[model samples]
Every structure is written in C-alpha cells, then in structure tokens.
Target chain A: AQSVTQPDIHITVSEGASLELRCNYSYGATPYLFWYVQSPGQGLQLLLKYFSGDTLVQGIKGFEAEFKRSQSSFNLRKPSVHWSDAAEYFCAVGSAEGYSTLTFGKGTMLLVSP
Target chain B: EAGVTQFPSHSVIEKGQTVTLRCDPISGHDNLYWYRRVMGKEIKFLLHFVKESKQDESGMPNNRFLAERTGGTYSTLKVQPAELEDSGVYFCASSQGYGETQYFGPGTRLLVL
Candidate 1:
C-alpha cells in the first residue's frame, strides 16, 4: 500500500513571495506523482505530474515540481505567489498499475497574505 | 468538453436518512472514481468504475453505501441509514484510460446531522 505525507498542515506566504510545499511518498516501486490545487468552491485542478523523462515538471500557473527518487519527494514550488494563489494543495502518489486509484496526502492549505 | 459534474452540490440529511449522489463524467471517459474527504482528513478513494462494471471497491466503508454505474455513462452512490460519520465531501473523477490524468468534479458536500 502506498501513502503520502505532507508535513505542513497550513502555510502562509506573503504576496509576491516564493513558496514551497513539501510532499513525500511511500511506495514500493517507481511512483507517478501529481500536484493538485483546489480553490474555494472549485474543483481540483491538476498542477503537474511526473511520469517519466525529465525530473523537473512544469505545470500551469507558473508552478513546478521536481522528482527526487533518493528523497522520495515531489515538492511543489513557485517563484512568486499572488493573492489568487491561496488554495488547498494536495500531493498524490500513484503507480503505473492502477495509478488511477491515487493515494493522496492530507493536503496543505496555502494562504497568501498581502 | 464539460468536466465531471456532480449533482446536488450540497446535501444535508439527518442521521438514519437516505441520500443519493450522482456523477456525470466527461464524454468518452472510460474510468470513473469516487472519493471522500472527512473533515480535516485526506481524500480517500471509495471505488473505481471501469465503464459499467466495478473495477475496484476496496475502499468502500461499509455495506450501507452502494454505488452503481449502469450503461457505462453516469454513476450514482446511495447511502442508506446514513450515519454521522458519513458527513463529508464526496468527489467524482473521470479519466480517459488507465494511468491517465483524472479530472475531478466540484464534489457534493454531504452533511449528516
């Protein structure tokens, strides 16, 4: 069984400040990783996903994440966050086999302050 | 194309009552899934439907919850004798195929009082 751990429950970043949300996963083999964001009253939107090839994957909204096998981590990062970036972010892990059944972390709520 | 849509964005029912949630996945999507998020908890998978057949239902909490996807189009989840513990947000997601990126719905916020 695979699982995701997001140490931070909530993160507050000032507007125009950089942001980093940590995520770690426990899986037996190579895992497919993803980042999703959900704004108030909105559906979960895919930020980015790492399947194969490049270790660094860029996503929509100027977000990027890197897959570090040694660290078992796929942390989401943004050079500068805006007030509109306030939302809840989730880190999920999946496998090529039945990866559709994703294992998600508890999620980290990002708050952008003025 | 329309993203996955769930009916009754919010549902409030008393304990022991019954509630049914509906999900309409994107057209041409072959995989549909159900997930739930309890207050302050992680979103957990409830089941997966591959077309009209249930591919995996290992995460279903109990028999009080029943899910069906007939004709391989839309899906429904019914909770009979709902309990307080059942209060949560139920989300529906769809994917084109195996290992594909899943598109999620806005979710139905179910509150059992």
Candidate 2:
C-alpha cells in the first residue's frame, strides 16, 4: 500500500519568510505525487504534481516541490510566504495501476504571521 | 467554467437519520470521484465514477452508503441510517478523463450527533 507521511502537524511562518513543508512517501514503484492546498470554506486546489521527468515541479502561487526518488520524498517549498497562503497542505500519492485514486497524508496546517 | 459544486454545505442530523449529498462536477468532465475526511483524519477516497457507471467503489465504507450518477450528470451519495462515526466532510471531485488532475468542490460537512 502507498502511504504519505507529513510529519508536521502545524507550521507557523512569518509573512515574507521562506517556507518548507516536508512530505515523505512509501511506495513500491514509481509514484505519482501531488500537493494540494485547502482554504477555509473552500475546496482543495492542486498546487503541483510529479509524474515522470523534472524532479523539481513548479506550481501556482510560486510554489515548487522536488521529488527525490532515493529519499522517497516530495517536499513543498516557497521562497516567501504570504498571509493569504495560510491553509492546510496535503501530500498525496497515487499509482498508475491504482487508476489514479489518491491516498492522502494527514495534512499540515500552515499559519502565516503578519 | 464552473468548478465542482456540492449542495447543502453543512448538515447536522441525529444518528440513524438518512442524509443525501449531491455533487455537480465540472462541465464535460467524464470522471467524478467521492472522498471523505473524518475528524482528525486524512481525506480518503470513497469511490470513482466514469460517466454513469461505477468504475470503482472499493473504498466505500459499507452497504449503507449508496452513490449514483444518473444519466452521467449529477451524482448523489446517500447514507441511510447514518452512524455517529460517519460524521465528516464529504468531498466531490471531477476530471476530464483518466490520468488527469481532479478538480475538487467545496465539501459538504455532515455532523451526525
């Protein structure tokens, strides 16, 4: 079974500061990774995805994630944080054989301080 | 184009009561998915629908939960005689087809007391 582990429960960062949310996964084969953000009273939005090439994938809102095959990790990072970027971040893993049904992590809640 | 939309954003009901949740996926999206997030838990896949057919329902908790997409349009998930453990946020998502990013809808929060 493929599982995603987001070790951070909640992370607080000052506005304009760099931010990084760690995500680790355990899968048998090449994995499809994704990062999603959910704001209060809103739906989850895709931040980025990693499937084949390009170990580092860029997403909307200046977010980027690097997929390390050896580390089995796909961590999300941003050069600067904004108050509007405060939301819940989830790391999910899926397999091509699984028909793309995702198995998500427990999620990390991000709080940006002004 | 309109994103996925779910009806009755929040619902509070007593245990053993029936609750039905509806979802309208994005226009022309052929794949619809159902997922849920229990309190303090990760969002989990409940099922997947390809058009009007049940492509995969292995994630559904039990027989009490029934989901249908009539005429390959709007989909409904009905939980009959809901249990207290069923309290959670139910999310609906859609995609143009297989191997595509799924667009999500604002979830329906169900509280079973």
Candidate 3:
C-alpha cells in the first residue's frame, strides 16, 4: 500500500515571502508525485508533477517542487507568494504502472497575508 | 476545453434518504474516477472507470454505494440509505488515458442530517 503525509495542517506567509510546503510519501518503488491546489468552491488544479529526470520540477503559477528520494519527500516551493496564493494544497503519490490509483495527503491550508 | 463537470453542486438529505450525483467528463477522455473527502480526512479514491467498464472499485465503502457509467459518456453515483458518516464532498475526475494527469470537477457537497 502507498500513503502520503503532509506534516503541516496550515501555514501562513506574508506577501513576497518565500514559502515551502512539506510532503512525504511511502511507496515500494519510484512513485509518480504531484501537487494540486484548490480554491474555495473550485476544483483542484495541478501545480506540478514528478515522473523522472530532473529533481526540481516547475509548475504553473510560479510554483515548483523538488523530489528528494533519500527523504521520500516532494516539497512545494515558491520564491514569493501572493495573496491570491492562499488555498488548500494536496500532495499525492501514484504508481508508475499507470493503472494504480493515487494516494493523497491530508492537505495543507495556505494563508497569504499582506 | 471545458473541464469535468458535476451536477447538483450541493445536496442535503436525511440519513435514510438516497442521493444521486452526476459527473460529465471531458470529451474524448477514456478514464473517469470518483473520490471523496470526509470531514478532516484525506481525499480517498472510490472507484475508477475506463469508458463504460468499471476497472477498479476496491475503494467503495459498501453496497449502499452504486456507480454506473452508461455508454461511457457520463457517470452517476447513487447512495442509498445514506449514513451520517457519508456527509462529505464527492469529486469526479477524468483523464485522457491511464496514468495521465486527471482533471477534476468542482465536486458535490453532500450533507446528511
């Protein structure tokens, strides 16, 4: 079985401040990792994904995540956050076989302040 | 292109009543999935459909839950004799193919009183 863990339940950051959200996963082999963001009353939007290759992957909305195999972590980061970035973020892990379902983390609620 | 769409954005029903949720996937998508978030719990997978066939349903909670995808265009999930624990947000997602990135719907928030 696969599982994902997000240590932070909520985080607050000031506008123009750098932000990082922690995510860890337990899987047998190399897993496909993803980060998604959801605003109130909206569906989740994919931020970024890590399949293979470069450890640092760029995503939409100036978001990026680094895959650390040694720590089993895929942490999302942004150089600077805007007030509009406040939302719920989820980290998920899936199998490379393609048919396996995704296992998601509990999600971290982000609060951006001015 | 239009994303996955779900109908009846919100639903409220008694514990013993029944509710049906609908999902219309993106055109040409071959994979559709159902997931739910209960209270503070993580989003959990309920089932996966490849076209009109159910590929996986191991995550379904019980027999009270039934899902059908007729003709492979859209899908419906019916919950009968709903329990209080069933109050949560149900989301539908679709992908162009297996292992591809999934596009999610706005979700239906079900509240059982």
Q: Pick by DockQ: which candidate is best?
A: 1
Tell me the docking grade of candidate 2: medium
TM-score of 3: 0.99
Tens-digit lDDT string for candidate 3 (A21-114): 9999999977999999999889889899999999999999999999999999999999999999999999999887775488999999999988
What DockQ does each prediction reach against the true complex? 0.84, 0.78, 0.83
lDDT of 3: 0.95
Residues A24-107 of candidate 1 have per-residue lDDT tens digits of: 999998899999999999989899999999999999999999999999999999999999999999999989655759999999
lDDT for position A90 in model 1: 98
For residue B98, model 3's alpha carbon misses the true position, in angstroms, by: 0.8
What C-alpha RMSD does candidate 2 show over the true interface residues after superposing them?
A: 1.5
Fraction of true A-B contacts recovered by candidate 3: 0.82
Query: Which ranges of candidate 1 are over 4 A from the true structure?
Result: none
- Candidate 3 docking band: high
Give the runs in model 2 whose Cα sits over 4 Å from its true position. none
Question: How much lDDT does each candidate structure score?
Answer: 0.96, 0.94, 0.95
Chain A (alone) TM-scores for all candidate structures: 0.97, 0.97, 0.97
Lowest-scoring 10 consecutive residues by lDDT in candidate 3 chain A? A94-103
